[model samples]
Target: MNWDDMRVFLATARAESLTAARGTLRLDPATIARRITRLEEAAGAALFLKSPQGYRLTEAGLRLLAHAEEAETALSRGIGALSGSAEQLGGTIRIGAPDGCATYLLPQVCARIAEAHPDLDLQILALPRIVNLSRREADLAITVSRPKTDRLHGERLSDYKLSLAASRAFLAAHGVPKSVSDLKDMRMIGYIPDMIFDAELDYLSALGVTRVPLASTSVSVQLQMARAGGGLAVVHDFALPTAPELTRVLPGDVALTRTFWLTTHAGPKDARLDRITGLLRDGIRDEIARLEAMPVARNP
Candidate 1:
């Protein structure tokens, strides 16, 4: 019934671990357990089913979550309205970002934020599983595709170009392809099912093709596989220079490209969110320019 209790449930449901929920909420374990227990008691039903894997929402829990989220949204609006004039950005900012930002962009931005605003807590939760902002799982997000929902306010921050790359050793072993038609003969490492390009089926389709032999999978795994000289992979240019072993194959003419969007809930304009988003936008702008400067081998 209490807002705090519902928040605890929502966090637990998203994290599927009481310990993780506690960390996100910055609360102690006992307090979180007690809150959830009290909420469950009040609801007269079990919200979660605990098993070895993790917390799974019960049917009652799922039903309650729908209503709880609406309540939270209403609560957020009211809080934003009341505190609209607050002068400082002192609260925690929860962000859901892809692995790229987690690896490339976050450290510098986080360090800057820490030095500039010691009072503001930054929580960067890198979920390969994208969090739904509408549910308040995150206050802000950086994603490749902007949400097509009225509930979100977003902007395309930068356009990212990706190229197929391979380690010299792998290329020497498997031999580089001279044309898109040659890809069928080559062993290719690619992102797993949920990856941006993997989901779109556009990365290859743009080449006027479909389906490549899958040698290895997962974004994290594909990077390693390609690095180990296992096979060719499509990766963002920012990832290329950092990965010393990988060499770009198909040039700018054939590379895959997509835009990154900075998005937030369509709530009252938040100064804190705007501040962080602005910094990120500026930082990535420099990165994109640097990427554009790199030498690209144009396909014949």
Candidate 2:
């Protein structure tokens, strides 16, 4: 089979549906079907078994997947090698991250990278839930926990702090809690407990916070509600500078630590991605240090 047919087959195999694969391949479902049929004819095997759910790979398909992925990796390396100088390298790179990092951290980090590589295009997916790298939804993803699967490679990006916080206006009207016990009777803002995607984010539960009167799955939403004097919320320490209206409450009593992990699909190295990752790693760490160093409102 030709490389074109193999490319379509690879995307279809990963997505498991002609319609789903259409999004990434930018081809119509009919075109994808035709290409898959041509590929199967050339190989003289039924690569996929059709079912109600989607396309299920047969044993032969599974075997071909390994070679196909290796070919893709080789193509990536070839492109990286011929991509000329790092200064002139230009292509789109998509990043998936939790809203806190997406909203508060990535803009400046990406802006600097874009400034350096004027031809490069960057897109950030600010998702409340975990980003699915296996789906090829993002070229790179930032996560709270280290990935467990061997199909993905993960690296610790940085460690940042979190703390209970409230707006100055909220404390003025509702008063501050003197003890963690007192928080039981107060209004709180945080993630919807049932919707929390990661255990590392369950900061309020440890504070004996059983109820969140104002809750959301998105960190940016919780920060806005807290800024509007909604209630106490567990907020990123590095994010405090961005929300000066909100003040840290019982910083000593509620300090938390969590690490950000950079993740990518496991494959042969691509120099372009390697360089971009280095810039991102260094940029994020420096930005956090700078933001956390800025003066933030805190209670005595």
Candidate 3:
């Protein structure tokens, strides 16, 4: 009997209806029925009992089911093993990362790969939602938190420092506060409602400052608000220096921080991914050093 027929038998047997099997397989119902008929004729026994409810599997069908599942599993594993044998680092590597990570980190990584391995293909999925590596949704990932699953290989890449900042125009109009207590009277741009635990909130809360309830979910919007001289926001040091008008508030001692991580699945070795991770680490390290070295206005 054909393995194709056997696979159809398993599908039809499990689904209990040719219509359902067709839907699951995305094939026509007649095609599924034809395959079932072929399988039953080869077996010389009825595989299912038709009823008003659905097709119920016969004892013969159940017996074949065990073998069919085993065969399918073995076939899948064999295919995976075969693919893993390739030593070339040229296939598409699906990578997922947060928004800023994609914007700040990937360009440099892509440049490095282009210089070294031009044939390598990279597909990046940039979203705030973390995709599952265990489910094969992504081949590699970079996240703020290390995944707890044993199926992943997670690593802490580095920790980043954050500070509260605003445009000089905003500070001038809003009247710069000299003390942490003075923060209550000042207008402040806050994290979006859902992002109350973000760096901005943490920094304000740590200083015993009362945050203004106005919040924007988008990081880009928050930056824009600060840039428009609307209010103060907690921006990462790397981001702050890029804004010509933005200046650090309480520069000497800020409590906001976040950690960066590099993570991947435990797959066969890939030189492209290894080289990409190395570039990302170097870029982040360089940025951190640059931010730390820049002097900010001291609260005198």
Task: For candidate 1, give the lDDT.
Answer: 0.72
Ranking by TM-score: 2, 1, 3
Which lDDT tens digits does candidate 2 get at residues 1-300? 778888898888889998899998999998888888888999999999987688888999999988988888888878876663456658888999999999999999999999988988999999989998877788899999999999999999999988889998899899988988889888999999999999989988898988888999999899999999899998998888879898888877788999999998886568888888889999999999999888887874
Q: Give the TM-score (vs. native) of candidate 3.
A: 0.63
Per-residue error for 111 in candidate 2, Å, reads: 0.9
Number of the predicted model whose lDDT against the real structure is largest = 2
Candidates in order, TM-scores: namely: 0.71, 0.95, 0.63
The best-first sequence of candidates by lDDT reads 2, 1, 3
Q: What TM-score number comes out for model 1?
A: 0.71
Candidate 3 residues lying further than 4 Å off, grouped into runs, are: 1-89, 195-214, 266-272, 290-300
Residue pairs with colliding backbones in model 1 are none
Give the per-residue Cα lDDT of candidate 3 at 53. Answer: 82
Query: Ten residues in a row with the worst lDDT in model 2?
Result: 80-89
Which candidate number has the best TM-score? 2
